[model samples]
Target chain A: MIILDRRQIEDLIYLPAAATAIRDAFCSTSRGEVNLPPVGHITFPQVSGDCHIKYGHMQGKPDFVIKIATGFPQNAETEGGTGNGMSLVLSATTGAVQAILHDEMVMTDMRTGLAGSIATQALARSDSRTVLIVGTGPQAMRQIESHAAVMGDHLNFEVWGRSASKAAQLADKLGGRFAVRSVSDLETAVRSADVIVTATGSTKPLFQSDWVSAGTHITAVGADAPGKQELDVNLVARADLRVVDLAAQCLDHGEMSHAAVQGLIAGQDVLELGQVLLQAATGRKSPGHITIADLTGIAAQDIAIADVVLKAYRAKGGRDV
Target chain B: MIILDRRQIEDLIYLPAAATAIRDAFCSTSRGEVNLPPVGHITFPQVSGDCHIKYGHMQGKPDFVIKIATGFPQNAETEGGTGNGMSLVLSATTGAVQAILHDEMVMTDMRTGLAGSIATQALARSDSRTVLIVGTGPQAMRQIESHAAVMGDHLNFEVWGRSASKAAQLADKLGGRFAVRSVSDLETAVRSADVIVTATGSTKPLFQSDWVSAGTHITAVGADAPGKQELDVNLVARADLRVVDLAAQCLDHGEMSHAAVQGLIAGQDVLELGQVLLQAATGRKSPGHITIADLTGIAAQDIAIADVVLKAYRAKGGRDV
Candidate 1:
């Protein structure tokens, strides 16, 4: 099997292609063309760390993906730990090891960011600009790059964070391609933005429901696990259109779970991203629609992205070692 | 990460050490010291192939292991497939990929064979001499090698299979160190042997219950998944000592499951290998006792064996590639 390091993986990513693949993967998952077993999770409470194992195979696909992503917050303090992860691509026909991508969670962030961009591009108004991103992290950077890659450089961007210096730093790093700057007032950013993406690890709601205006689209990316919430339950309930990557997953965690728990929404009330992509379910109806896409992540995305990477490696004549 | 191929893994294995590690892993599992998540599986019905993902971490250990094993019987007919598998060892402290062992199911077979030997050595009578192994497969070879590795080479071994030539070939291949010969009459072989090991993918009992004699110990090694059985349900229910690797897994799809479905056994009736190893449960009670160990395999064993391989590599001054 060929082993690609994180740098090699980063060099191979084409956000536009990845976005397309991820969109198709979302559809495949909703259409029941993939086998996604229950995720395996191991928690280390002593160090506040946890590891997640997600694996799946899409029907008719050449390869299956087994992904392992881990988080150790305490390690960052002394070990300079940036969460590590890798995905293995194996032949679906013979179950032979095909390739190993030691991307160190880069693929995860890329696929997630692509999901955010895909949802935003499909739901946000065509004339939308002034996209606001909450939090200054790797995902925040990915959100900007993927959105720019898929949505174009015509849209203006604003970043908001608790620390002004960090937010400005992020803008400076990503400022070459698009118009981006740091903003201090989150409320104003929420009210005035055409689209909002919340990517923080906060357990409580990041913003109030009343701050969001009509005709706005929000993609909540941070609340992918239990006890994580990025939007007010009322905001989720009040949205005119609700799109999710997967209903079962979104209901178990993520931003929609809070609304679901409060009896504001049921499973049937939500439309999957795949369904929307397939036109099996309706997306935003009018400019007045307040749309939300809750992405809790899924294994299908990993399989899709891995396939994309493997294709790139093959094109480059990468040899098995 | 360091990548070790099948040959490297084979050279690194010390069967006695592996048996010890597997035995300790069993004990750790029963003591609730390991975080073993439910296994993930995907099936490819068109190819009659299936892949299983088992992973876990033992508390206080330096690393965790995620194992992927796949079986593609149809591929063997056309693609010269011998099955494929790999294990990833990651640091538990930071969850970083430490080493990758692309053993191609070599590690799997070794661990399984070692489990059989460990159980046999612990339960079989000291004076036992004649050993009978049913079926001629890789597992059958592993059972013979591992049994000799742990139980010494003084005992006589008999091979039984439907095809006399295949059984004779197996016996000839393994006849260098010990007395081994292919026997024609399975009933005589089973009745005369002091110990019996069944290692086949048979879905039905290989031998009748009445074929087994007093003072015999049988290690049923092939009924790992559902729709597979090597011992009659009556034989399983009739054993004086019922030992299992893990009660839940064994009862789910192994030889024990058949007896369980017939309401012939319950969870409490079986003694886990770890419990017996820890002296928390009984093994063979008398010289005339009939004992059986049903192993469905567990992630803890994979983790244990992976650790053993990784240590061997490190000892050789293997550098990160």
Candidate 2:
């Protein structure tokens, strides 16, 4: 099996190519060309860590993918420690392992960010320029980089976090490359931005219904597990059009999960992004319509990104690695 | 992360040590000192291939293990193709990956065989000599090798397969080092043997209920998934004492599943081998009692085996990959 380290993956993976592949994966999934089960989880509450296992295959593709990603809340606090991630790509026909990616959650973050970018491309207005990111973490930076790569460099960025200094520091770091500002008030940032992306490990709502603008499209990327919410129940209920990366999973754990439990929206009411990519339904009908895409993430994103990264690595003459 | 090949694993893993580790794993599992979820499956009916993902952790342990194993029934028939298996061991406290074992299902067979050995040690009669292996596959040989390692070399072996030549070939191979014979009549072999191990991919009964003898301790090592039964329903129902590697899983897909569906045995009646290991219950209470241990394989077994293998590798001075 080929072994790929983090540096190799970073050098080989292209976010724009990943976006294209992810779009195709979404279209294929909506067209019933993929076989995937819901994510499997092995939880450890004592150590404050958990692992999520995702496996899937495209109907006629050459390769299938299985990924195990860990989330340890205390990883950053410990020396020489970090959350873990692994992706194994195998032959679809022969079941032979093709590659092992030791990404340490970098691949997960990249795929998640690309999903956010895809949602913005499909649901957000074309004229959208100002972007507000609700958290200043690795995921937020990845999302910004991918969005900039896909949506052009003309867009401005605003960073907001519970810790204002972190938000300002992140904004200052981004200012070296693009137009960015850190806002102390979340409401002013939410009202002014045309697009919003929230990626946090918060247990309560960070944004309310009254803070959002009519033309804004919010891609809530965090709240992957049960009982984690980033948006208020009423905020999700107030969106004119609600979409999700995976409808069943979003209803169970994403930002819209709270709204679902409150009976604010039914599973049938929330559309899938794949359906929108297939043109089977509309994501955002008008510039005046408010849209929310709750992305809990799925296996197809990893499969899509892996396909692109492997192809790129092969083209770069990295053989047997 | 450390990378280990098949050869490394074969040279490092010890079956007797693995048996001891597996017994502890069973006890830990029964005592609720392990964290494991239900096995996750991804099936491809068109290609006749499926992948099983098993992962778990022990309480207060340094590492946890996740294993992904694929079974493509047509792999052996095709050119340059084989099934795949991989295991990732990560630190429980930090979630940092420790090692990757690209075993290609060798670890699976080894652990499975050790489980059978452990079951035999706990349930088989002390005077048992002749052993009947119902199927002449790799797993059958593994069971024989592991059982012989844990038991004694004085016992005789009988090989029984649908293809008599294959069984005779296996017997001839084993005869080089030990006493072995190929038996054509399954009933005669079952009647003459004190311990029987069934490892096959059969969907129906291979041996009848009346073919078994009293005081026989059979370790049914196959029928891990749904619709795969290697032993007759009546044969399983007629066993005086019944045990399973994993009760919930065996009741769902192992030899006892069909019996459970037919209302032949209640779930509570089927005791776990862990209880026997813990001395909470007696296995093979008397020499006259016919015992059956239906092993569907669990994550704990893999975790147990991995821990031993990793420890052995570390002791052998294997460095970072």
Candidate 3:
């Protein structure tokens, strides 16, 4: 079996291909061709750490993947500081392990980043050029980079965060090749951008309903846990189309849950991102359509990315290529 | 992280220590100190294989474990053959992975054998002597060896199988150090033995209720999946004390389920092996007490054995030693 450490995963993971694989995974999922069991959540209350075991396999796929990921909020005060993970890909036919990817959270970021980009590509207007990203964390940065990779180089970016200096620093990093601006006003960034991606870890709403534009596509990447909200319930109610990375999970714990709890939208009304990708369901109704894609981060994306990474590794003749 | 291949697992795994760890795990489980999620069963009909993801952690323990096990029945006809597995032990405090034990299927066999041993020691009468084991499989052999290891060297053995030659061969391998005899008459073997351990993969009952001797402690190690049975319904009802490795699981797919379905017994009435170990529940009531331990197997046993194996590997100072 092959092992890919963090550096190897970083070296070989191609964002464009990852986005395409993720698109297929989501599409397969919507078509009921994916077998993803309910995630196993083990909570350590004493240390406030949680480990989630997610497994998934697509029909006719050569491999199935199981990922163990842990998040410790207390790690932020210490040197370790947060989440890390490892994933295994097993041969479907013989039930033998194929590879052990010691991704160390890189694949997760890559998959989520690609999910955002893919969603934007399918749901956002073709002529859309302005982008606004919320937060300045690692996830937010990856979303910006991955979106750039999938959507081409002509788009301008507006970065917003709680910390002004960090937001400016993020804008400066992407300033070399693109139009980058750090915005202090959240409402202005939300209203003006053609594509809005929210990646902040928040318990309260950050954006309102009226601030969003008519043709803007929003990818809500945060609010993965219960009681986490990125956009107000009114914003969700105002969305012309609501899509989810994974419908079951997103409806349970993602931003959709907030809207569902408030009776703003029923879960059945929400579309799956895969459905939009395959055109089995509508994505953007018109140039003035407003779409919301709630990102809960499913196991299908993880396995799909693992397949892409391992395939690349094999194509290059094994490790360290 | 320490990775122990088949050879390393064979070298490092000590059954007596594993039985004790398994004992602790069960005791903790009965006391509700163990956090074990429902086993994730992902079936692949295309390959005729299935992968089960199981996770468990005992409160106040330093480690938690997740095991991914797959079974492909068609592999037996081909090269790969039946079962393969991998497990991870994570730090309970930080949720950081501590060791990766690439134990093929040795730990599984060892753990199951140890479970039989532990259950026998705890539930069987102290003066137990004659032993009758059905089937000449690896599990049946291990049960004989492990039983002798725990009970005493004074015990005699009777081996029975569908083929008398296979039974005689098994007896020949064990005859050197102990009183081992191959018996063709199943009734004579069942009636004369003080302990009966059935480990066959039989779809029908292997022994009737009247054939069983009084005070005989039976460990039904076979019948792991649905529709598999090694003993008749009457034999199950005849057991004075019915103990399960895990009550919830056994009552669903194990021998207890058979009894429960036939209106012979209620699931809640089945005793837990851990309850017997902790002395919280009655084990053997008298010298003539007939007992049955339904060993469907569980993640607790897997994690417990993982703990013991990892500790042994770390104690021997690392990778090779």
Task: Supply the global lDDT for candidate 3.
Answer: 0.83
* DockQ-best of 2 and 3: 2
Among all windows of 10 consecutive residues in model 1 chain B, the one with the lowest summed lDDT is: B74-83
Docking class of 2: medium
Off-target runs (Cα >4 Å) in candidate 3 are: A76-81, A172-181, A225-227, A319-321, B77-81, B162-182, B200-204, B223-228, B319-321
Taking the tens digit of each residue's C-alpha lDDT, what string does model 2 give over B178-200? 77889999888998889999988
Question: lDDT score, residue A118, model 1?
Answer: 94
TM-score of 2: 0.97
Give the candidates in order of TM-score, highest first.
Answer: 2, 1, 3
Clashing pairs in 1: none
DockQ of candidate 2 compared with the true complex:
0.69
- What's the TM-score of each model vs. the native? 0.96, 0.97, 0.92
User: Each model's RMSD to truth, in Å?
Assistant: 2.1, 1.8, 2.9
Candidate 1 chain A: 10-residue stretch with minimal lDDT? A74-83
What is each candidate's DockQ, to 2 decimals? 0.73, 0.69, 0.68
